[model samples]
Structures are given as C-alpha cells and as structure tokens.
Target chain A: GAGVSQSPSNKVTEKGKDVELRCDPISGHTALYWYRQRLGQGLEFLIYFQGNSAPDKSGLPSDRFSAERTGESVSTLTIQRTQQEDSAVYLCASSPGQGAIEQFFGPGTRLTVL
Target chain B: DQQVKQNSPSLSVQEGRISILNCDYTNSMFDYFLWYKKYPAEGPTFLISISSIKDKNEDGRFTVFLNKSAKHLSLHIVPSQPGDSAVYFCAASSGTSGTYKYIFGTGTRLKVLA
Candidate 1:
C-alpha cells in the first residue's frame, strides 16, 4: 500500500513569498497531522485533523501558518508571507483513526526561504 | 520548552550488536510513547511503542522500555544491521483518543557498522 507522501520534495522561495506543501495520507487513514523540523531541532507539531471533528491548530507557530484537510485523505500546510525562520522540512503523517497510536509520516517537503 | 529530549545526538554500533537509543520527557500528561525510524530522503516509519502504564513492550528484535517515574524511555534493537543506520525520533502524546498532538524529541542519528 502507498504510504504518506508529500509533493515538491524541495522548495526554494524568497522571503515574504507564500508556499503550500501538500500531503497525501494512506488510504483509510482518518487522522492526519503536520509538523515542522528545523535544522538541529525536533519535530514541532503544527496541526491535526481527525475525521470530521474540528482540526487542532494549537501547534501553529504564528498566524501566518495554517493547514487544512479534505475529509481524511489529503492535507495542505500553507505559510503566508514566509520568513527565513520558516525554512525547515515540513512533514505530514497519518494514522488509522482516532485512538490509533502509530502515525505514518511522509518524506516531507523541504521549504527553504531565502 | 522542550517537552521531549534525545540527549545523544548520535550513536554507533557494530553489526550484530545491540543498539540502544534513549529519550526523556518533561510532561507528566504524556501517556503514550512511540519510536520512529527514518532513512535519508524517506519518511519516518513507526518502529515500536509503549503505554505509560506498561514498563516494557517487545516486538521481535525491537523493544521499548518506559520509566514513567523518571519520565524516560528507551528503544533497543538487537543484532543491529547496517541498514538500520538512520535517524530515530521519540514522540509522546497526552491523550489517546481524538487529539493527536504529539511532542517529538530531536532525532538521534544512528550508524551501524558492518
């Protein structure tokens, strides 16, 4: 089966530009998540979507960061007015559903803001 | 604050030897812990996990041990292989139900010498 996957393996954008990272979760996965991995840093939770419930956006670092998921299949993370600080690998993951423990991750989209 | 911490930046083990990776957490609300392995240019794959109530969980050659009192956990791989060289991440979550807000630690790079 196909695992989670991300598009634009690498993105080089200028500061103040907006970029969208896409993610396709595994089939039948109802829970999806987004995280950011900065250089020499841990993965920081960004947002989460489970079934039809309201998405959890508590992890978004700033108002410029946001994410959306269509039902339970695909997700996208968007950064408005990108900053150099936003340069990092954006990762997406998914699980079977609520109460599921394991989350399968995507290769990630490396966003480089110059 | 760093809720989870992987103290060792990297570790090396000879093939056919034991490989141990350590992680610590500062949040008492975390009830589930998971380990993930990632190779270059690839996504992270779920390895093993342990519940807060349990002290240990084993799966084939992989085992996860949790010390809730010390807020610590470790992943042990027996007969480490050269293919096992990659980054290992430790993640924790507070609730096991609807919310999938995971706190991850900085990954530890592992090298297996053949």
Candidate 2:
C-alpha cells in the first residue's frame, strides 16, 4: 500500500523567507501528524490533525509555524519568516484512526535556512 | 522539559548480537509506548509497541518491554544485522487523555557492525 509522502525532498531558503512543506497521507488515514527533527535532536511534535476535529497546535514551538489539513488527505506546514533555527527535517505521519498506536511516516523534507 | 528521553546518543553492536535500546518518560499518564526505526533520508517506521497494561510485546526478533512502575521502556533486537544500523526513536502517548498527540524522545543512533 502507498505510505505517507512529502514534497521537495530538500529545500534551501534564505532567512526571513516563508516556506511551505506539503504532506500527503496514506489513503483512508484519518489521523495526520507533523514533526521536526533538529540536528542531533529528537523528533519534535509540531501539530496533529484527526478527521475534522480541532488540530492540536500545542507542540508548535512558535506562532510562525502553522499547518492545515484538507479533510483526511493532504496537509501543508507553513513556516513564516524562516530563521536559521528553523533548519530541520520536517516529517509527516498518518495512522488508521485517532489514538492509533502505530503510525506510518513519509520520507520527509529537509529545510535548510541559510 | 523533555517528557521522553533517550539517554544514549549512539550504540554499536556486533552482528548477530543482541541490541538493546532504552527510553524513559516523566509523564505517568502515558499509557502507550512505541518504537520506531529510521534510516538516512527517510522518516521513521513503526517497529514495535506496548501498552501499559501489558509488560511486554514481541514480534519476530523485536521485543518491547515496558515497566510502568519505573516509567521506562526498552526495545530488544536479537541477532542484530548490519541492516539494522539506523536511528531509533521512542514515543509515548496517553490514551486515557483522549488526545492524539505523542511525545517523542531524542533518537538513538544504532550501528550494527559486521
């Protein structure tokens, strides 16, 4: 079966620029999540979307990071005014349903803020 | 503060040997624990999982052991192969909380030397 997918395998952008990362979850998946991994750090939860429920933005580090998921399909994570600290690999994941323990992940998009 | 923590940054094990990866959590509410493996240029893939109700779960060569009293969990891979070299991440979620968010630990890099 098709797994989660992300666009722009790699992106290098200038500071203060805005970058949008896209994620296509597996077909029929009702839960989607976005995470970021900084250099030598753990995967940090950014946001989560489950069906039509309110998205969880508690893990977002700052107000500049926001994500939108259309129904149970595609999702986009936008970072406003990118900074050097924003450089990291953005990963997307999806599960069969809400509260599902196992999650399938995408290849991820590596964003380099230069 | 990091709710999940992987104290070891890296580990090296000889091929065909047993590999053990450890994780700790500060949140007692976490009732579900999962382990994920990741290779370079890819997102994490679910490896194994265990619920707080059970002390252990095993699939093939992978086994996950959970200790609710200690707030710790470990993943054991028997007969580790060179292909097993990658980063391993541990995640925890509180199912009773009704939130779909998961707290991930900093990953541990595993190097299986042949």
Candidate 3:
C-alpha cells in the first residue's frame, strides 16, 4: 500500500471481551509504532517495532496489552479482557528505520468497549 | 505527571488570524519535537518537526518555536482557516535511548470560525 493501513475502522466490544486490531505498515518502512488516543486526551505511545522485532514494548500499560509484527509488515495489537477504559482510538504509524522524526500514520481503529 | 503537557484543551480563533498552541516538557533528554494534526475519526498526520540543535522551524503556514531553557514549544498557524480546525498534538522523542517511545501531550483543539 502507498500508506499505512489498519483494519476494522471501528470495533464495539463488550467489557471483558478480547479484541484484536491489525495494522499493515507502508511497504519498505522498517519502523512501526502503535498509540492510543482517548477522547480529548493526547496520544499515548503503546509499542514500537523495528523490522520484525519490537525493541520497545515498555509503553504497554499492563499485561493485557500485547503486540506482534511479522516480517516487518503486518502488526496486530491484542487486548485481552477489555475494560471500558480501553476504549480509544488506536493508531499505527510507520517510518524509515533510521529516521526518528518522520512518520506516516494510518486511519486508526476506534475501539469502543462498552 | 505528564512530561509533555498541553495545558489548554481548546482554543477559538478567527479566520485569517494566527492560532498559537503551546506545549511543555519536563524531560531534558528529549532532543526532537514534532507536531501532528488530527481530525475527528482520523489518525494524526505529521505536520512539522524540529531538532534540538535548532530553535525554530517553519513550513508554509505552520511554524514551530522551541525554547529549550523553558522546556516549552509552540506551534503557530498563520491565516488560520476553517480547514485548519483540528486537534494538534505535540510530541517529543528522547535522545535515542528511551525505547523509541515518543511522548505526546494531551492535545489542543483549535476551532477556526470563519
């Protein structure tokens, strides 16, 4: 794809249910990132992947949050036992591995945990 | 405490006026700063960036000013238009050793009344 892509523009899940969000980064982009944005709140970094490995997973708030990337292309963020607090817009971005400032973002998936 | 803080939650500006959004960071290790613009239901898009070595950067109608001593940065948009009405986020990245997580502020929503 010319730009980063994410699946399921919106997800409505019940509390305590599990959900999975997918992100397909731009071709040739080695750096992928995940972030969460709550209503009226600023963005919160969740995870970052360099190639197929996630060098930074420190942003994961709790054990219920986890992410994985395959072949440095498609990435999935799994939220187990979702809570109402987990409701937010999950954004995925990609950039050149060597550049720290330039990043392209996806449309994001709005997860509404009721 | 929030390392990157956007104190103002919302601002209203007239068309053709200048809109100023402010951000502050407590961490001195942040060497790179960026601004991202986000519309409702859409992901954030990169606007501009500035390195620690420089105090100012400008692109088209948007300009970013950095004050290292105060640990503050601001984005200025000249001739604000209705199309420019969106939430702006200020992000900061540490000096390449902080797990590559870019800290983001709470965001400032700009409303341009034409």
Question: A1-114, model 1: which lDDT tens digit per residue?
Answer: 998999989999999999999999999999999999999998998888999989988889999998889987888899999999999999999999888889989999999999
* Cα error, candidate 3, residue A71 (Å): 1.0
User: DockQ of each model against the real complex?
Assistant: 0.81, 0.78, 0.65
**Least lDDT summed over 10 consecutive residues: which range in candidate 1 chain A?**
A67-76
| TM-scores, all models, native as reference | 0.97, 0.97, 0.95
Can you write out model 3's per-residue Cα lDDT over B1-114, one digit (the tens) per residue? 789999999999999999999999999989999999989877789999998989999999999999999999999999899999998999998747634468899999999999
Stronger candidate by TM-score (1 vs 3)? 1
Off by over 4 Å in 2: none
Candidate fnat values, all: 0.79, 0.83, 0.74
lDDT of 3 by residue, A12-97 (tens): 99999999999999898889999998887778889888875545888899999999899878999999999999999999999878
Angstrom error at residue A15, model 1:
0.4
Per-chain TM-score, chain A, candidate 2: 0.98
lDDT of 1 by residue, B46-82 (tens): 8988889899999998999999889999999998999
Q: Is candidate 2 or candidate 3 better by lDDT?
A: 2
Residue ranges of candidate 3 with Cα displaced over 4 Å:
B98-100
For model 2, residues A9-114, the per-residue Cα lDDT tens digits are 9999999999999999999999998999999888888998989999988889999999999998999999999999999999999999966778899999999999
Q: Which candidate number has the best lDDT?
A: 2
- TM per candidate, chain B: 0.96, 0.97, 0.96
